[model samples]
Target: MRERRRLPRPAKLSVEGESDEFVRPMRRSWTCLARRLRAPPLTALRFLTPPSRRRQRCTPGAAMADVSERTLQLSVLVAFASGVLLGWQANRLRRRYLDWRKKRLQDKLAATQKKLDLA
Candidate 1:
């Protein structure tokens, strides 16, 4: 009777009960863990959080356009001041360059006049 019961158990087994037995379950676990770990932070976060508590994703298109009037005025004032300072510096540099060029030309002319006088 025991032998007869054991004989029918082979047909009930899901597989042939061979070398493939341990492999399938382990492979399935590895694949599942790999997929879970490979998920992006935002995607994995969704699984860890409840729907009601899930944070809204920050979209690049959203902007904070509310600027204070005083900030605008200050920025404009700063820009104008910087422009004035820059213009003053540029004018000073141009004056110095012109003086240097004129001195160089006068020195060259003096040298030529001396050479002509000696000849």
Candidate 2:
């Protein structure tokens, strides 16, 4: 009989999988930093210090109101953006979950049909 040929194993498959999971957090942090770097400098500066101290010669209530107004605007913008992201993520997750469930049910139905045929 002729000798059977064998394929060579990849050198790094196991290690590559482990390293990919290990680097995931670092990649996420880098993306977060990159996003922060790309965002408007004005918003970054406003948040660097407490809002009251940044504005001069204002009464406590007025300072609070100014801070509150700015805070409200920022909160609204963040909420809207995050809401959009979350909604998209939720929709994707729902679709994936439904697809998975449908696949599983089909698999079970197929198995049941096979058993019924054998019986």
Candidate 3:
């Protein structure tokens, strides 16, 4: 796969209101061992906080939303699937009813012809 490169930003203005400074790894020895790649512009502010605390202020669950964004997506998916199932079932029953009605009418027509011939 080809890797995408970002446009070089002007030195004066910071990208995404945050500068991509050289981030020091947790340990000095580890940094020397691994070849460091250039970091991307900090578009997401969450990275500024410690990894231990994502939603809260330097601590987990200090301030979190009651429902996550995923809940809305899941509800929408379930409703759409239910609608599709109901529609498919309705079409199947409608076809069966129409076929039965056509057969009944054909039988009635055949019975009438038999009586006419006897007369």
Candidate 4:
């Protein structure tokens, strides 16, 4: 099996507008090679806040109306559309393969019956 290389986290501007709140990971020259292999860009941001120390700055209703929520919804819609297309193509390919196999088996059976009749 071909091994997939892990993508290095890209330099991100802090969501809270505090540069010192989050520290970037150390630079590794080897990660440059990993990027050249066409790996997907790392979009997930790792926040430094501990579970107990973290507080919800905005109300739940406000978060739902935020720009981030719209972006997330758009991403989800694109993913769902892509998944549906892929599944349809896969179902089509499976049906074609099954049909071809059925025809081949029927032909083989007919040939065997002819040989039996002649014997």
Candidate 5:
């Protein structure tokens, strides 16, 4: 059996004010390497970190302050009208399908009756 050849380990490149623990063990792509090299250590680290979720919630009236009463009413009316139209179309299709099925069954019954009369 042949012995496996060992590959040389890549030399560690240290950044000022950054720890070795932060360095990824796996191989990084050229784009990621380029981005890290381009930006300052602090700026790069800042961008990499997730955003803080300590944002203040707006008051109930504060959100509606920008929106006018007429605009709000119009939006509500449009939503209601669209919902009604969709329901009407769905009902119409269902009724048409039921009618078609009933007609088909009646035709089949009539054909069966004709055969029975002939016999």
Candidate 6:
């Protein structure tokens, strides 16, 4: 049978007014500190926590189903407009690139032709 090794426990701090009671030392590891620091503030956490049963019953159908037809149409319109704007921007960039390339090639051809004429 193998003997089990017991890990050392963290040191505890005693409170000034407490007798026979000790508080565990705060973890100082980077991960522990990061978790503590990254935790949402208490006010924000209040909204994130599960709501009471009464509040759940008060709300209507699923959130997605609650959207009005006009809102849906507007959202679709916005999405289509954004897609068109993005495509226009992309084509503009492509045209600029092609123009720059054509100018570069023309300049190179002219330079070669000048050299040939000089020779």
Model 1 lDDT per residue over 22-51, tens place = 557766765676686684878665666556
The number of residue pairs in model 1 that clash at the backbone is 0
lDDT of 6 by residue, 24-84 (tens): 3333443465676596878884666676666464356676688989999999999999999
- Candidate 5's residue-wise lDDT over 9-103, tens digit each? 45655567867655554234434555755857676656666788887688778989989999999999999999999999999999999999999
Q: Write the per-residue lDDT of candidate 2 for residues 19-40, one digit (tens) a residue.
A: 6776566567656766866858
Candidate 6 wrong stretches, greater than 4 Å: 1-61
TM-score of 1: 0.46
lDDT (Cα, 0-100) at 40 in candidate 3: 47
Give candidate 2 misplaced runs (Cα > 4 Å). Answer: 1-64, 68-71
Alpha-carbon shift of residue 106 in model 3 (angstroms): 0.7
- Local distance difference test scores for all models: 0.73, 0.77, 0.68, 0.76, 0.78, 0.75
Model 2 Cα shift for residue 41 (angstroms): 61
- The sequence of per-residue lDDT tens digits that candidate 3 reaches over residues 42-115 is 76545666556445444345433554779868888999999999999999999999999999999999999999
Candidate 6, residue 36: the lDDT equals: 63
TM-score of 4: 0.44
Off by more than 4 A, model 3: 1-66
Of the two candidates 1 and 5, the one with more favorable TM-score, higher being better, is 5
Candidate 3 or 6, higher TM-score? 6
Among the numbered candidates, top lDDT falls to: 5
Predictions ranked by lDDT, top down? 5, 2, 4, 6, 1, 3
Which is superior by lDDT, 3 or 6? 6
